[model samples]
Target: MLRYYGVDLLDLHRGTLSARRVLVLIRHLPRDSALVRALHGEEADWGAVEHLLAAVVDHLAIGNWLFTSAHGDSEPPRPEPVPRPGDAREEETAATPSPRELAAFFGGL
Candidate 1:
């Protein structure tokens, strides 16, 4: 639909939508969608923002299942460990820049 890929996608990409609004839209977006692919690309990782949003989404889903589906009688599932940047197991591990490189990139020591 135009609303999904056009208007809502633009608002999300521009950060013009609220966190909750963005989350809802993001949930409905297929992983193959352009917006999802762009936001979650290897060349353009928004590190902390991505992690926090993922945690919120995961916890929300778990909470909903626990409360509504399980009738508040079951213990919630344990949270998944946060992903480490540059982990050796990653599909594309990142190398830490040297001090000199960092200084050069930052324009100072």
Candidate 2:
């Protein structure tokens, strides 16, 4: 599929196109079924193609660094905790501070 887009699959495979880069490239993929078939030929299983495409997109969303060069530097993204429905009110309360905020406040001391 990368070849169909005139992108060298070898380059991507060689890590020249980082996982982050593949995601940017995949966003440009043609979404129509007919176009997909045309590119992959008659053997293209729409479901499988869709699944692989989705997997690539998912990896990109997760910020995989597989494509990065040995010299490339990426700061780890700060994670945000998922809020539980049961803690909704506590989450909103000004009296309660999040772990991050509390850490920041005490760390200065």
Across 8-92, the per-residue lDDT of candidate 2 in tens digits comes to 7577778776777667666566645465566665444545656677667766744544444333587555333333223356546
Candidate 1 scores a C-alpha RMSD against the true structure in Å of: 15.5
Superposed Cα RMSD, model 2: 21.0
What digit string (tens of lDDT, one per residue) describes model 1 on residues 8-58? 556656887667876776678765567766776652354567878878887
Off by over 4 Å in 2: 33-109
Best candidate (score: lDDT): 1
Question: Deviation in angstroms for 108 in model 2?
Answer: 68
* TM-scores of all predicted structures: 0.27, 0.25
Report the Cα RMSD per candidate.
15.5, 21.0
lDDT of 1 at 44: 37
Q: How many residue pairs collide in each prediction?
A: 0, 1
How does model 2 fare in lDDT?
A: 0.58
Model 2, residue pairs in steric clash = 18-67
**lDDT against the true structure, each candidate:** 0.64, 0.58
